[model samples]
Every structure is written in C-alpha cells, then in structure tokens.
Target: MRETREKVQLQPLDHDLAFLDITTEWDLSSSYHDWRPSIAVPATFVPATIPRVIAICNQKGGAGKTTTALELALALIARGLRVRIVDVDDQEASISVWLRYYMDDRPEELRYNLRDLYFNAKVKLSEASYPTDFENLTFIPSFPDLGEVDEKNPVGADTCLQRRLRQGADDVDVTIIDCGPRLGQLTVSALVAADDVIIPVKASSILDMKGVAALQKVVNVVKDTLNPDLRIAAAVLTDFSRSKMTRRIGGSLARAYPDAVILPARTNVKVGEAQLAQQPLRQFAPRETTTLDYDLGARVLFGLGAAA
Candidate 1:
C-alpha cells in the first residue's frame, strides 16, 4: 500500500532553524536541511569504566529538566561510557521523543541504542528494556499508562522503582532519571532508587525558590526515612542569562548549597532546537554553547577535575 507524504515542519522555538521530514512507503529520510552541519567529538576519550545514575529533577516546570537529562545522557555516551535514562514524566514524554529523533539522525555506525521503561508494578525491569540506535545509551520510556499505575497504586507505587533499582540498574555505569515537575509518588520512587540527584535551577526567578524548598524537603525526608546515602550531588543552573540579577542568584544558590556545584548558565538556542527535533544537543549541535555547558556540568558531577 502506498502512503501519502505529509510535510512536517518542526520548529522547537521561535528560532531561524527547522527540520523537514519526507515519508515514503516503508521508508523515511531526514536531514538538517535548515541547520548547519556540525561535527561532534567523543567525550574526552575516557577509559572503560562503570556508569553512574544521576536524576535531573526539579518541582518547577520550564526549568529545562528533560533537556538536562537527554543532553547529559548523550554527552556521557559520546564519552564512551554506557549510559541509560529513565524518563518518569508520564504527562510530557519529552525525552522519549528526543531519543526517537536521535535514533533517526545517525550514520548507523555511530548511533546509540535508546530504550524506554514504563511504570509497571508487576513487570520486572528486565522486561522494560528497549534497544536504540546508540550503542552505550538505553532508555526506560514512560507513557500515559504510567499515570494509571500512579493513581491505582498509591502507597506502594513509589516503592516499585526502588525495588527495581535493587534488582536491576547495576548493568550500566549511569542511569539518569528525568523526573516530573511535581513531587508525586513517582518522584518519591526515583529518589528512593537513586544514589544521587542533580537539581537544575533556573536562575533570575523567585519561582525557583519553591522548587528548591520542595526538593530540600524531599531530600530530608528520604535521608531520614528511605536511603540515607542519597545525596544532593549538584544543583546546576540552567537558562541563565548575563546580568547582575543572574549573577546574584547564581552566587546566592552556590552559597546556600555550598556542597552542591553551581555550574555556569548556558543560554543556547541549539539545545531547544534539538529538543524540538527530539534530538540531543550533542547530536544536533555538538560544539554549540548548550553542549559546552553540559560538558562542564558532567565533568563537575563526575568529579573529573576536583580532588578526590
């Protein structure tokens, strides 16, 4: 059967960049028709090592949570470490979409495999794995059905992932969980399962204070009730612009959370554009400003330069 071709113009933000998709019978082809061709380099040529899991979470929406998750996942994978992501947001499957486009725009030789893990109380982690184009990266995707699981199982819902983390999550070096915008049962489960958390705070807004407060509350609760080892490894600053107010909040947050690292604020359009195409910033614009920010953030969290 022949299928009709439809023009899909994807513009993630109000930028001068876009992507075109051509669909044919049993086939699809795409290219960066509007974007400039940029080559991405491997992540610092690190030796073979075990991966680690970091959860990029914040209660405030529009804080670039998923972008942080996917960008870091792709950056780490490019560095030759095996990485996987668990997307816990059922309402907005943003990471899931990015992985799909990432798989699409590849040379078939250097593509990383991405997978998704949906919320299933009864299903084991072994059953949720899916293969992607990238070699070192896999994803556990979340869907709307996850909302059902969240609603039906209230008490034990948050504990499900904790059980899976114990039973599984040791195969790879890193498992990054992109959490929802609010403190729900799923967020609780991710905290219980995670060894560390990466909170991205958008600077220049008092609105972020609420997220910080909520995050701190959860951390205290989890440290007391659940996993004592759970630490606030880093609180990254995102979407930061150059101004006195920006520097003020950035400095304040760094002081308030002295243990956490406050990396520089990167305002890159390529990051948003990649998200619109469901692609990672590294894959779309590797040398772009956003990718550079992610690289630095990864280094700090991974403790590459800091004294050990």
Candidate 2:
C-alpha cells in the first residue's frame, strides 16, 4: 500500500490538466537588476464552437453596461450553450469581482459557473479559464488592481486581449466582453476583437442618442481599420420605464437602428441585489421581468426566435 501510494503521488499531471496553487511565500517583484527566466508555455490553438464574439459596449456611463453583459451571459448559459465572459473594464472589474464573490458566498447549487481571464500581455489563454458549477457557463475573472493599469496607460492600451481571445475561441461557444464606459483602447480593443457589438442605451434623454452616435463612430473606426467584420449585432434599451418620453425614445431608436432590439422595460431592486450578491438575475430572481427581458434580448441577439 505504501509503494502504491508513493507511485500514485509521483505520477505526472496530464499535459492538458492544470491547477492553481496560491503560494504566498514566492516573491513576484523584481528590483531594477534582479531578474530570472519566466515560465513559458507554447501557444496552442483553441478552436471555438461558434465564431461570434460580442462586445457589450456603450460610451456613456450608467447605461447598465455590466448588468446587460452579465444578464446576456447568464441567459445564454441557461439555454445550455457554453458561454464565457471577458472583463475589459479595468476601473470597475464589476463582472469578474461579482463572479468571485458569488463563488465565495453561495452554496454549490446557487453558485454561478464562471471562470476568469486576467488582462495581461504575458497571460496565456489557459491561465484565464476556471470551471464553475454551471455546465454551460464559464467566466474569465478580472482583478480590481487592473484599474492601476488604466492610470499607467490609455483605455485601449490592452490591445492584446483580442489576440488572446482569438486564440482561445475554440474552447467556448461564445465570448462576451464587458467593456467600460469609455471609448479608449479597451473599448477599441474589444471592438477590434469582437465579430459583433451590442450597444446598451438607457432611455433618459437626448444624451443617450449622443452616446449611441459616439459609439457608432467608434464602431466605424473599428470596422474601417481594425476589424472590418465587426458590426452592431443589437442595441438594447435598458431601464425602460413606462412613460411617454421613454416610448418616444424607443420608437426613435428602433426606427434609427432597424436591426436593434428593444427589450421590455423592466428594472427592479432584485437586479441590484443580484449584483450585490454576485448572482445573475435569472438565478437570483428567476420570475422577475428582468429575467424575461434578458431572455428576450438573448433570443434576439442569437436569433433563436421572436422576442420572448
């Protein structure tokens, strides 16, 4: 029995099998002079089941950008399709942190199935993947410290996320990039990396129109130079309240972006609570209208059928 145990312990891990060991004793910082060779893994191609990549972006703040992204991801996963999220917003890191907190707090049944992919130049696609409880849901976690990367460089400076994404596409059915509320390099990079862009507009005033226009310009830039295949997949009207003005705004937007999808205007405290608790609305408030809207939005984006 001792020899058998020793043999089993000495067995090497499979080539594709890996795990994380968060050791604190090792020092990561290097002085101006001290240096050592960093570990390198040969780049391996990761084929994607679906070629579509969606970038949830809007130039305006308070557009429910993160919420929209998370909802869409959760909806797709609920449909039994594999989905992964990429956190490109360095400032908030909202989506990634939520996934971590959910994993930390929830029971196994209630836990969100997600993984994380840190945004870094040297980061391999493998380091970004982690398994979760959901069969079809995966996440690419981000860190709050990523905000520091913003201060050091411009927003779109993290351009390599596109390359990394392309390389990792084969592992999942879809990839959703949660972009920050800025048209900097991060947004630009996301646009460049994605095959489609979903613009979320919060119907407040003429400002939303202006925000959409600005986002359109960025999309054009990405199409004209960076990613010609990139196009607007859908424009979602979030926080839609029952009012004459909101109705008018929705009509105008629908007429302008004929291909855009106008989902039901349903917002609730449960949504805010879900985010606070790091849970998706579908999991936190399955019966809420918010879940229905998200499901409808996903159907429109995926062309599964008419709005739910």
> What would the per-residue lDDT of candidate 1 be over residues 269-301, giving only the tens digit for each residue?
776677677666766776666666666556456
* Tens digit per residue, CA lDDT, model 2, 1-308: 11211110111112222211111111124442452211111122111226578899888887878888888877777665677887777655467666553344435443322112223445467555554545555666655555544455644454566777777777888889898887876677778888877777886656877888898888887788878867666666677555555555656665555544445436578877887777767677776766666665565556554322
For candidate 2, the clash count comes to: 15
Clashes of each: 22, 15
Positional deviation of residue 25's Cα in model 1 after best superposition, in angstroms = 57
Alpha-carbon lDDT, every model: 0.61, 0.62
